[model samples]
Target chain A: MASQAAIGFTRGAPSLDIIDTEGLVEATRLAFAEDPAGTTAYGTAVGYAPLRKWIAEQHGVPVEQVLVTNGSMQADAFLFEQLVSPGDAVIVEAPTYDRTLLNLRQRGAEVHPIALHEDGIDVDAVQALLESGVRPKLAHIIPNFQNPAGYTLSAPKRARLLALASQYGFTLFEDDPYFSIRFEGEQLPTMLSQDTSGSVVYASSFSKTVCPGIRVGYLVGPAEVIAGIAKIATTTYISPNMVSQSIVNQFCRSGRLDKSIDTVRAALRQRKDALVAALERELPKAEYTAPQGGYFMWVRLPGVSIDALADAAAEHGVAFVKGADFLLEGGDDSVRLAYSGLSAEEIDEGVTRLAAAVRSLDA
Target chain B: MASQAAIGFTRGAPSLDIIDTEGLVEATRLAFAEDPAGTTAYGTAVGYAPLRKWIAEQHGVPVEQVLVTNGSMQADAFLFEQLVSPGDAVIVEAPTYDRTLLNLRQRGAEVHPIALHEDGIDVDAVQALLESGVRPKLAHIIPNFQNPAGYTLSAPKRARLLALASQYGFTLFEDDPYFSIRFEGEQLPTMLSQDTSGSVVYASSFSKTVCPGIRVGYLVGPAEVIAGIAKIATTTYISPNMVSQSIVNQFCRSGRLDKSIDTVRAALRQRKDALVAALERELPKAEYTAPQGGYFMWVRLPGVSIDALADAAAEHGVAFVKGADFLLEGGDDSVRLAYSGLSAEEIDEGVTRLAAAVRSLDA
Candidate 1:
């Protein structure tokens, strides 16, 4: 099933063009000069400290609160492993990140979906679920331009969501991998930045801004939760790749991270704009959310079956994630079109093909 | 405790010196060109196909049986998480890798320790443990020159160990990170290579041979086990870093992997000899096992507490892992010193310090 997904899409990843091999060589050289033996050996489970400290400082959280991981995905997995056990109820946003939903479901969590609106996941729906005795172990939200959906949680809802979380007694998993990828909209305060009850377990990643070739991300929560995750980390990867972590730390510390982020932000915004505009011109009838940040656009094709659209689109020289793939298969009518890793011409071409596919589905 | 460990080891990695940054750059560049989007974006859970294929080909396993992971540590953790639930019976060799032991114990497993002999784990003792009503869920072993103990499981004993596992209905976790690092000894067939029962969940790494800084490793096992681990990997890091995985795959495919292994083997053997000779000259009273392969030497100080020795050595600007750290705390009088990371002069000076520390403990 996953292999088929790979065969389908023409992905756009700017980081590929941006990965500084010269920098890695320089870092590797510096790293070897300092500790040749330690490089090949195991590292700390909490991640490289300087990197952790940098992340904490970046987020305005205490250093102890930040924990490094292989990627934000790993961080999410750690949160689930530490908090959500088998048979536990998880409150997830519908049309959410497919992988996050899959992780929770695979772990045997009784996943209950809270509908996502244009702004983000509905607070009232979550409240209703909480009141109806779902007793969700966690509420996983990608408040900042959520994957695929590209829907940032509104500021008004953020406070209410926190309140609901406090009242409901379920931890909130704020996965904001694309937090810094904002191109057009005002940045909302993070759910974690406002969280007061210690009910938020936050995850972020450098895959978007820096480089994904190394797979370095982080998890932040209470110390106990972080400790549990650390135990998991120890058992799992021993410590994350210290070499990559150290390189990233150096990259960020040396001010290269800021420049890289600027590069990614401008490129992504241009790519996102081109894709959105192309889709509008080519298929205005197809309903899709206009994204402020991030790489994906959740498209709802009214009167067109997503599976059929996906099949047709692929046949027409364009490929995208069928909405049903994001849902429990055979459960939803949404299709996720990721424009994050495409060139302007490719995006236009892909959307044009998608438009043709959509029209064919209606016919 | 973990913080202290991370702090004490502040030097650069040795394997980084061996890494061909130019080759790596070329590989990364090629990989990015092919899957520019895949390398930066979220990828399949099982791992990148090229890397997985290479790993499968290397292990002589089917492609379906291989999983590329962040590192072997993650593979170990994933297997433990999937196979050993809380209070699950796990059989481990006493004086095993401390991190692996910690991984299982922290997961609430009833860890049954089998004594280690020079040849391998005491199969008779393991059989006795198996017979004594502890139905073991898993038997984890380092079949090559293992951590701390640095003892290879003998060929005859390997069959006996597998037989015991079969008789007892337990899975064998064959960790062989050091398998290809052999210098002086004859290369033994791995448990996975010889297994007919489809039982061994094998793990290995490029850290020892290429450079651990990149943190690329793999796990090979039955399809069901690999599937289960894949679910965990999906949640953990979604997938391994595609760039790293692809680069390593390319490097391996180019046939440099064998040459790289040979380089590491020669370097480690030289360091091991230097350490051994230093021990002979400086601390003749300390009974030490000369490792035939891999990076560690197990030194036992009779009538002197290894903890005291470690502390005294630390004071004198040298450090070694106390045996107690490897086993459950409050272990036997042994210390594990790794020579792979340090220079020959450092090894000699460190051992000389260790000798003085032993004298100080006696005094």
Candidate 2:
């Protein structure tokens, strides 16, 4: 019925139930109680020292290699601004985060879209493009639980990409926000960790792990580039949100962050199962690679036009992102359904509504 | 002795004693308990609606005219990106906030520096430039307690600026973080409030009023431009720190913000008086405009090179910014001393040390 509430699978934000509210509250108290100066003052653009140290310890990088930002998106934007000057060529997955693509284009970067497989981005395609004298300044890779597609890069491919970046003299932007959210399979070594040369610049966020509203994210790279980005950040906003970083630092140190991640993983696992089962039973014609973990399931119906289905799906009280929105071109028949923010019941309901819309479109 | 601790006048941050720590603790609790979704979710780049509504009510604008950012500096950068393309001319105060000048130059804007008097920016100079066919796309004005200079814009100049902006088809950017921190005389109306035409985009921050670590700031403009900026914010970073904004909302709603502002004003007034008295007693040759309110006092030593004075000042356990840092060129004898972050006794001590430094420079 039209009166039924819309069951949205659009945003990849975590559900309220999955967040550790009690832990965050306690963490906030600890942050304020312990270090009032670090928590309340105008912290330098290098970020709160303790938070950076914590991240540095986690990554095995020196403290100067880390720059804490408002969010990983800000980190992405800063690195893009630093690396990709106007008219410089860059490589990206065919279906990448639209926001990153928009930023690259805004900076006048010549975008080269490489195809992606279930294992992750086409490294051979990137190598081929590089061999063809593309000479990209940057290669933006999601690395794990890739947005829109939910594909993780294989270890071999990651190694290859690093090598290509080293050889091509391009920066490999390892945008790995979902690295820790894997509910299944062994985590692959990051391109940053794998790089012998300083070709990889890594980015991750506490948004998905700790909660989005805290706005804590960071970048890890060579000290030189990190210092350059910090300079840009210093001029951009004198500093990031130190209060949030302080709280997040507490969360990480207090073992609450790991606990919260476990809780979110359990909930997401259930949601993903519900989504897959519902899709199989309801829209049998649809095709997708089952995501091992992360927030999304990318699917394409054999004959359905996503634009028409989107309107029909809305009337049927379901919402999802059209996959074409993530790509520069193509994906007219595809959709990206984020299961992270929904429960099993909501996922089932949303998939039913989506199936009903597709059937209606055919009729 | 070389072992004395440095009393720095470099940062314009508030002294922690004036921050309402107890009130903030309560606000954080209230924000977390009352509005869990609004405080913890991935709020839209347009910002949390309640916070936007509050800011809109404060400014007497529609909610659509507001876009909350990580900080007002981000608001400044976004507007610069939106308005000034490469080589587009823009006007700014000569010895203005330096970070602002950096962002403008980074965007490749041809910055036309206007002079400032005790009353405010030299509107006549801007008028001359515009009259002489330098059609600047935008003019950045800090109407209240201008940074580094600590001068307030006169009402007449404010009116003329609004008129000039309208007549020349230029956007008047009123970057007024220090608007509410005025501790003396009658409060002046914002240029945004006084403008009859839709030519003004105004920004303000909770960094000075509430606390810096929160990183909550906002922009108000016509709905169309606000929408455009919101779009840019969305692609750059999906949203701002909602937890911080929610706490700030609580701080504002419960009247704690008013109390905090009162405490800060009282403290700043004492520090300002101490600074003026000490300057008179210690270094009669150092000419300065005694600011009635705000954090900074701009002073020019008749013949002392700031570079030499800075080195001497450092050794004497005092620190102040060389005002030349704020200008593109030619401020070799000026310094900006921020007294807000220090107590009256500390200001006196610092000025004494500063006098000693000047003596050393003469030697």
Candidate 3:
């Protein structure tokens, strides 16, 4: 069973070795030891106060503009619930996060997909859609390193997206979990930072940076929007997990978060480099982006069907996500490979196996 | 500010002294020490595996039928998201949990509130609603120690309610957060325990039984329903808090939960006794149920508006939730007093102050 098991390139999980498990455990222990009762009692629906304030300060926002959530996904869910009425127009990038697409579809939004380029989503296409007289209630974008796409939205596009949101009267829902994971390239200004019209609702998660098991995230937006989301949160989860929040709060306050992120960034850079080199050596015909950071790389194999490639790759003991899963329309020749959880050696082996699978398909 | 503060009878929080804080801290510590990586990594959207298995074992259900949630409220949100469409009929107890009512309202559920009596909800009224051709998508009930009412659904009513659900082709959403909190009377069989038709979606929380800050809860239902809820959970929060679930799993497996429950029951029973005796002495005119267990006592003050009484009580150094907050139609002369958070002495003082408030309103 072990011999036949696939080398996984489909998981977005952070490498376990990179996680500061000792620090997390110590923080949790301290949280329980210091104030067990307070830590274990019901917290406000918005989140634990100190954590919310901390996040607010980090984002240079007022506390009223910030709300802590179970995770960034919960933040997305709450904002979707608050903004997307049935049949409302919602804009999404073509190759966006699949779960976000599912959420928008479930919310009954008429999702308009804008083409995602190497630099970012096509702002001109979005502008065209807006000019077509579709009044979108929200536009969900990952301005930093996008999931599945691994492309950062250019600074110019970020500015334009903010302007479009203002002109079209839609909320720019910026999901930026990988904003701090950059290993190269200059950091782009966030859509939230660029927006003067209070149209950007920014969300980020500790899942990628700290620990997903803690389930902590924060949303920053206008006070009224935050309050509305908090109300939804009250009826949804009552409160975010205070025990985990307290632990995270301690981890942040102790300045361990910076060190943890540094370790993660360094490790991820190594893995990303290994995957890119392996791809070049093994799959010469494959077209792919070298992501500066984040978990995924969008790969296009010329003359190869993504479905067949994925199936054959699995049989050859390597696995990846079919790119069609990320797109609403078409991606028959594409796949998404995640290298964040794999070691450099494992990535090399996985790419070699994937190349063998591709050759076998041709044979 | 401390001197002028009112005695608080308004909190739904469990007493801090009663929680086995040391045990909780130890469990958390053990969880971290045993498997920090597994405990702090991404888990399945359904929940942490061992915790789901444990809950399944406790409920005598299959693991597939159990999905751990952020809290019981999140379970409700998932189910509501799955089952209720806009304008769908939903049966709720007249004086149900305010959050449930708010969630239903937000979902655009045509909420039909049936009267809640001393022995739980008016089952006959529910039957009448069904018989009157109102086909509700779900009937939500708190079978044991119903929130704000301090009533248990009789065994016969539970059976009848199940039958009604089957007859009406609606799910019976049995929310039993306080199931294990019984301090007196014989324990009633759960609606889920008696269910054979697979129409009951049972939800319960460790927040009340273990600790709220941990934010762990679960749902048991048909595999298909659980799968659907898990799908929603995927888009909602991605997964339940594994750190908390791991700790709760440790707490349960270590044979500490039973002892903790015993401690809580004893403390709550004492506080209930104090509140009951004080009400009898200080405000004999007010009618209230002496709850067998749970945190709340429902009081109906004769010839007094609850809002006015709540205002008067606050000014006279006491506080409680006005009954109107818990109802759909009317609770003008009622209020909900929670005794779980207060000490026995505080309960007596709070009641005495409440009596003074009542007199002041009359004066």
Ranking by DockQ: 2, 3, 1
Model 3 RMSD in Å is 1.9
Q: Tens-digit lDDT track for model 1 on B1-363? A: 222222122122453555555555555556555665555455677877877877788777788898888878777877887899998989888888877888887889999888888899999898888778889889999988888778899999999987877777789999998888888868888888888887788998887766776688788888989998887776666568765677677778777777787777778788888888988898788787688898777778778876666667666666777778778655568777777777676677777766776777767
Candidate 3 chain B weakest lDDT stretch, 10 residues? B1-10
lDDT of 2 by residue, A1-363 (tens): 789889999998998898887788888898888998889998989888999999999999899999999989999999987888999999999899888889999889999999989999987788789888889988999988889898888988988888888887889999999988898888788988878899999999999899999888999999999999999999889999998999999999999999998998888888889999999899898999888788988998978999999999999999999999999999999999999998899999899999999999979
Write one digit per residue (lDDT tens) for candidate 2, span B101-172: 989998899999998888999998999999999999899998887899999999999999999999999999
lDDT of 3 at A150: 91
lDDT of 3 by residue, A63-140 (tens): 999999888888898899899988999999989899999989987999999899999999999998888899999999
| TM-score of candidate 3 on Cα atoms, chains taken together | 0.96
Alpha-carbon TM-score of each model against the true structure:
0.85, 0.98, 0.96
Stretches of candidate 2 exceeding 4 Å from the true structure? none
Docking class of 2: medium
lDDT (tens digit, per residue) of candidate 3 on B1-363:
226768887878897788887787788788878877779898989899999999999999989999998888888888998999999999999899998999999889999999999988998888888888999999999988788889889988998998888877899999999989899999999989988899999999998778899899899999999999898788777788998999999999998999999989999899999998999999999898798989999989989877788778778888898889998878989989999899999899889988988888878
Ranked by TM-score, the better of candidates 1 and 3 is 3
Q: TM-score of the second chain in each model?
A: 0.93, 0.99, 0.98
Chain A TM value for model 3: 0.98
